[model samples]
Target: MEKQFSGQNQKKLGLSQFVQAIEASRTLAITTKVTELRRQGKTIIDLGAGEPDFPTPAPVCDAGIQAIRNGKTKYTHNAGILELREKIAAFVNKYGGQYQPEQILVSAGAKQSIFNALLAVCDPDDEVLVISPYWTSYPQQVKMARATPVFLQASERDHYKVTAEQLSKAITPKTKLLMFNSPSNPTGATYTKDELAAIADVVAQHDIYLLSDEIYMQLVYDGLEPVSMAMFPQIRSQLILVNGLSKSHAMTGWRVGYLAAELPIVKAAAKVQSHSTSNITSISQYAAVAAFELAETELQKMRTTFAERRDFVTQRLRSMPGVSLSLPQGAFYVYPNFSQYFGKKYQQKTLNAALDIADFLIDAAGVAVVPGEAFGSNENIRISYANSMENLAIAMDQIEVALKKLQ
Candidate 1:
């Protein structure tokens, strides 16, 4: 048999192990399925999206148009255009942090900025501590960097937030970085200043890097302000603050995000970005400057709308039978524990995991949602409230009815 091997018997090529280790985004997969169903004339209430339901601010859009008209559509500095970087520096400094233009690197989006920073800091076999119920991309990005991702589950009883003691115990000699997201994506848990300071003390003591993803910092509710890790001078040098216009200004498609770190780290990330995606779109960079400089009023209005939606969604979820959830402090998501119905059956199918419930909802209720298993928990499902009040109300009604049918 060995002697008879030929071209037809040769093994097929496959993707790299790094690429193979990570799964395709579950959120995007559900969204695509929902789109297909809608195209077939089905009315699907999609709550799987992570983007704001608002339009980009008028001033930011106008700036992009002006940039294009002025022939500003040329290659920019690999770290982004200078004016944008300067604006980013000033903005970060305003929040009680010290940053310079040279310390800022602008990439395609906050996701890219975080990925680039991970690649720049992580080496083979390095370990990244990721908080559970995290953004779907964090662990994937760590894997893409050829590093190991170690998860530490934040206390669900404490609103899915990691504490300083928990973080301190999780550290090992192999730990290279910690991924922290405030107003977290799936859970919408925000850290207070005291909590951040305590965690920052641990990072400082360990001398490890911290990647603070603050994309949702602007959407905090109840007059709560987000505290930056960079605001803590003791750990300032070890912090990489990643933020962008995607969330705050409803410019998700614009692809303008930046990171503030030490100069050397910024340079390293810039090199990585240069070899990958040289620079962000020129028009988007110009538009981002206007977003930072002139869109506060519009951004505030959007935040207010999101707060109202958050309250509405939380109230409805709490009132539903067999559903349990904590009120989100920020961000646009409500992750409800749906394990109460795990043993229930519908139409000869038994619902066991969060994915099963999600699939059942899509098939029977025509409501699309991302399952909690995608975020490292199988007992819950994530519902994004970044939709119209009317659509959300209707979706809640449909969900309640669909759940009641499971007996």
Candidate 2:
């Protein structure tokens, strides 16, 4: 006979097992800790944020206010306001690909667009090939959608960008999708037209869906143009182009993101979003229209500033001893490999991983950085130059002094 379970002997209630599979974002965790330390009167230089330091363009903000004043705050179409979608379609179609308003789904943010894409297509056991060091949310989103994340390391030797040959070898029968990011989060590596063409060929051959996260598309520096996977018309059916005004317009708080896919994919993703978040904020949708139209000049100014900061930060990090990194082609981050310091010690603490190094820098240098382990690389750490040059210079100096003490 089986023994009866009593209420006291039963397991305590907690988050669902499915939800528990996803871990809290290490980037956000570090940022929050730094914020708390700063509030406590600690002098902390934060370099962990992924957002631009610039403010949202005045015209875009004014559009939102105007919309509110006009009472354009009602519920929008579940797929998004038609006007915004049409503009998004036009903007995307300006490139090599073709898109229609009906094929676009505007969501709360690019983050939600990504989640909806995965949830719409992936089944419980499907596998998503994630290129590391990926944005930290990729794996968690895959898990939350009941899919498995398969990592293919984009090694530092290759400038942290995966090759088509590697992609071909990694694909299995279980692989249903690939999460692709250019001007990538941690390494800032962008793919050229030739590189994208090669990868597109592989993706087409495998018949797998490609989710191209181009949130940082307009942030590329050095006049390097990032090739969109959607440009390959042969594989357009397999492409889900994800983008937002967050990074491009410094509208991180606006929560405006969208995806352009084929009609079937758009409908499926919109269904997922409709059941969950419904339409994005109506005011944000209106603001995004102005963002696309009136913010280009201001956006260019922000880009110029980021380019300057990127150059300054990259040069400074390269000059530091035992630090090595490829010059990022785009995005505002410099991911420096600090593995050379791994067996060193400071006081009683042994630095064996990037996390340990991050902790050391925060405590000793009063600088906050996201550890490379969070991006699936143990040999490197990510530093964002999205702050003012004055703060960045001071942070780098503190990091230099802290690193020296490790020996």
Candidate 3:
């Protein structure tokens, strides 16, 4: 009976082999688990996810409401409405780059924008070079495209910024694209203009595209300006810039992200968007337009608050024994080195890997932090400081108490 049922199902329905290939990807699964635990009435203070805790600004919400009342619910264009594309092009041009509306493709979110770029450029057996301690999704997305992910290991010693020499050594004939994320997730490392220029010079020698994920560009701290790869004319032809209102305007639920590239690449990405997810919400596009037009003041307020939070959290981590951290120049995250406690025992239990430490923190301290292993490092942990000051203070105090029991 079992063999007959299996045979019938196997003949009628077949799952794609690629579906099984992605089972081990960690971000979505772990985040969902944490959310479920919280839903079950656990006292969980999640420092794991990378979303801002702020609400979308009132003006942006008002714009979306108005758009809905004015009958803007129907899909306008597959690539995005022309008005939004023009706004995006103008926004990109503000950063010393030339982009037309024809060169923009808006999608559901920055994640989808990245997926479109990778799918458009990658072929089977190609290599996608990613700098480590990167966002956890890069390698997964590369593998989904049937491309191999090559890690150029960056570390806390160098502030987690990959060097030109490192990238040069990693590139080969199979290398088709390099994924670069500044104000990086899990590590909070940002590259300077000079560093980007150096990397761009080497990429110019090879036939490689640079997928620059600049979602965190608006969150830079300490008077630092965010640099885009489009600023370099030498590598302009090979750069695809991805950004969105999800991070910058706290519009995560609204799901408005856009990619800026050459016309050919934009056309390819738009076709992918049309077939997969056609046109981000019409109301959301209006919301994004209002966000880009009128939320500059609110954006600055959010930036100031995040900078203070980053300072407070880094200071608290530094005060802990055997914990070391670099002052993240951008992004609202603190990636602290806790390698010294790996082999130590806490409460009769020996700590071994970062997952052990994460579990300990959650169970004993009531705080949730993502292990660096998920970001290609086992010696550190990422704590997002996007929560309120009071919560952050309490969480850090609890973390300190929990660490003292370790050794």
Candidate 4:
């Protein structure tokens, strides 16, 4: 017999199939473990974090405080406040996006902007091309939108950059979008203009949208300038460029991000957001305005610091025996192939996957890194250099010493 509606006899409501299919974030799991260890009075050097270790620039903080003083705490327009949108338009224009205030949608973060764009464009049977060694959220978000994430796996030999040929071959009739990231997360593989142009030529031939995630464009090093898919006029109608202040301005807690696209796409994303998060915090929007107005000198200081750390981490990793990675040009993480040590054993547990490497590091060296499996690869683990040099040096030294102990 069917169960009657009673708290005692009622069957448990099951979780959504869609959500059940999504994998829990391994990075967040590692973060939780690190937090617990710290709570237990353990000293853990966490290189797993994706956010900047730098504090938010002072003027930006002042802007938020000023916003509060002005009582500007009401819900903003769904597309964002006009002033912030205008400033964002100017910034987007500099990156080759000919966007107007009406063409932008500011969401909770670049993440939400991407999610909104995915929901706006992807149908149930649609396929989204994701680059492997990807940001952890890409495939999960695609799946959450009921779209299949088809990976275009780039080889470490290619510096983890997807080629035009690979992209051309990956596109099918069901392909609805391509998620392109430059100065990529986890790998820090930034593509050059020539590579981008060749990729653009392929996308131009297809009836697909390009959701370009350039959140780390401002953090590039090695005399590298930022390039954008918006720079390609051929795909302008099909382009959705997402950027946020979280990474660039050390405003992760502030939750401000935006997308620049065609008017219809922006309108659709606004519709999606209106049902979910509406606008981001009004205070943060005002602060984001000041974020754009931040002095170049302030940004340069952080960039220079990150560049030094990147160099230090790169040199350290390359010097380790059996460790190798392409020199990362941007972003703050170094992903070194630790697959060479996969079969090595610790006390009793055998190292097998990237997750094992991450776990073993925490136990052996008190170092916490995000496993490469979190980013759709298991041959390596991601070590973010978004920490102070002193901490970074200590972490690297501990890591090297710990590696020698594995047999």
Candidate 5:
């Protein structure tokens, strides 16, 4: 039986309408569904989330617990603990950028740091240029800020890189920021220094800001050195580099990420964070300090393992009949081009979209992968190999069999 709402109650609930763009956006939906299915006893192999499958390193967790025991749970400085700000400044400086403690704004996660940057920099009706295959949140966050997100498609033929020539074409007077992610989430593409310098030259000449999300910088593979946009002298004035301990230290649940920028941008981000989700978690801030100060050896081990998995998964994807993947220098995803599978039939149902292929894999192959639509592509899908070797092997086997079944 359904409970009926009173007329007055109905009117109250309907007063605030949801904006359609915000309501329709989804990428976390698949991960939530997979978790729900597992809770109901279904054996699902999830490659849908961009999270690590490893536990947070022991030392970081211990520090958090110790902070609580030592009664350090009070509210912290709005910008973050001074020590953390200093540590972050030092870390950012090592990347060939100059940063003072005043230029660091700590937020709940790297996701929030990105939002803070958009909020601080973009205005209503302003244009923000984002390259294709972006993190799903960029457009949605821009919409929430009442800004327009302009997308430029980066083709796989060019290794999915956005050239300075292409960027010059995308810019207009209204373009306030140009956003790109190296070691991108879904495609795992890392831009070369020369490529970045070229793009930086374009943005620098235009008087626009460059938003570089380097959250996966530490996970780079096969001798690829990830370069920061701030390293370019011309771009440093307008660059906001977002990074966190999430992937590098396996500290996703800790919710510690910081934005490194000039003093004005950082101050604005801190002010916004103050009224929204202030200070992050006091205990987690302490843990983050340890994450930044710890030795590099353990982190290197994680990177080595991810590199092996990347190679393994890329080779497996290539073996599939119609699937093709480019080798990525960083991140643990293989975005396989599956346009050849479109217009075919699977169980008498026509496959038309990347979402369709993803659903087929999950429902028929028992493997969960993110659709390319989540990353602004309709001809591809992302496969994450952050699981155990045995599980990744089994999932790949099932995926190949499932693709062959499509007519």
Candidate 6:
């Protein structure tokens, strides 16, 4: 029954409890707040961006332009253009998975690809295992599909990597899927091949599926080899491999991402996508084929630059007194504990959580960062080094000074 408003005959519509209970993405939330702050004539150094600082590769950009000139603006297949799927299949196969174009489903972004996979495999009330300090989207997407999210916390002592023992212990009859991200967001921790294999073995014994999010597969540093969940053939049949060109190819705005999974899962996700978004933009699909074809050249250049910036950020953070963090293996973010300053005062207010520190940084230090509470922890904050080296150096310097003033 709809209730009438207090002095009117009109009745306001209500929202579903599930939707009402959902929290907005804290990463994007901070980005929005930073934009608002900068609009007020305040100098703000934004290190909270989630995408690469580099531009999309030249070949990929040319491909998109060509597609537009060739009048390829109309919609294509619901699953995406055949040529793009073939390239995605070949790309995933190159990374250790045996895939065919029939199993690939292209979507708007890696975000949608993951959500499609979740909606395809999950039933109402099913539980999804989300390792903590996870991407802010995981649990929200799980809930959007009516699945309960079961969070397993990874300790900083382990470099935030979960072990096979923990994976085995977390599974239950109610668990329908495991959302695994390596070169994970927020923490930037990547698992080794042997470590992934052990966890894959545990999943192999269960009836659940593993949705490996390898969005950051191309960003590892410090002489580490990239490992995909698809590398382990034992779990291949049950693996739902998710990856895209956004991070590796710097095509965040192009909106091209795909999942290589079993045919049934692909078909199911395609059906869900069909009613919702239909095919992704035609020009973007054309460019994605180019991105896959031009593999390592442009990406290597960006990766090298990011590696240098990572080194600088790591060294600066380590020298700060009372600060501690795992050496991030890949991706562009650093999750560092700032709990030592929790009881310190800024103005007349005490810093009680990561949110407070984030607030203090933006207001006092002119820097923007996402609080750890956004990633399921309150003792740390995530600083994305996806900015210019000069900006990063200044941000770090200001962060250090602002932190020292907590007393």
Q: Which ten residues in a row have the lowest lDDT in candidate 4?
A: 3-12
TM-score per prediction, in order, is: 0.96, 0.96, 0.95, 0.97, 0.95, 0.97
In candidate 4 the C-alpha lDDT for residue 2 amounts to: 82
CA lDDT of every candidate: 0.90, 0.91, 0.87, 0.92, 0.87, 0.91
Q: Which candidate ranks first by lDDT, i.e. highest?
A: 4
Clashing residue pairs in all predictions, respectively, total: 0, 0, 0, 0, 0, 0
- Could you give candidate 4's per-residue lDDT for residues 349-405 as a string of tens digits? 899999899999999999999999999899999999999999999998999999999
Residues 49-156 of candidate 5: C-alpha lDDT, one tens digit per residue: 788888998888999999999998999998889999899889888887898888899999998999999999889979999899888888888887789999998989
User: What is the overall TM-score of model 4 with all chains considered together?
Assistant: 0.97
**Model 3 lDDT, full chain set:** 0.87
Pairs of residues at least 3 apart in sequence or in different chains that clash in candidate 3: none
- lDDT of candidate 6 at residue 127, scale 0 to 100: 98
> Model 3, residue 13: displacement in angstroms?
5.8
Spell out the clash pairs found in candidate 5. none
Off by over 4 Å in 5: 1-12, 15-18, 23-25
Question: Which is the better candidate, 3 or 4, if ranked by lDDT?
Answer: 4
What is the total number of backbone clashes in candidate 3?
A: 0
| TM-score of model 1 vs. true structure | 0.96
Model 2, residue 255: distance off in Å is 0.5
Model 6: per-residue Cα lDDT over 1-407, one tens digit each: 77644532324555556667799988889889998998898899998889988888888899999999999999899999999999988878887989999899999999999999999999998999999989999999999999999999999999999999998999999999998999999999999888888999999999999999999998999888778898788898899999998998889999988888989999999999999999999999999988888857677888899999999998999999988999999999999999988899999889999999899999989999999998999999999998899999999999899888878
lDDT agreement of model 5 with the native: 0.87
lDDT by residue (1-407, candidate 2, tens digit) is 87665433345544456665678999999989998999999999889999988888888999999999999999999988889999999888877769989999999899999999999899998999999999999999999999999999998889998999999999999999999999899999988889989999999998799999999988888988645777898788899999999998889999999999999999999999999989999999999999989746677888889999999999989999999999898889999999999899998888999999898989999999999989999889999999999999999899888888887
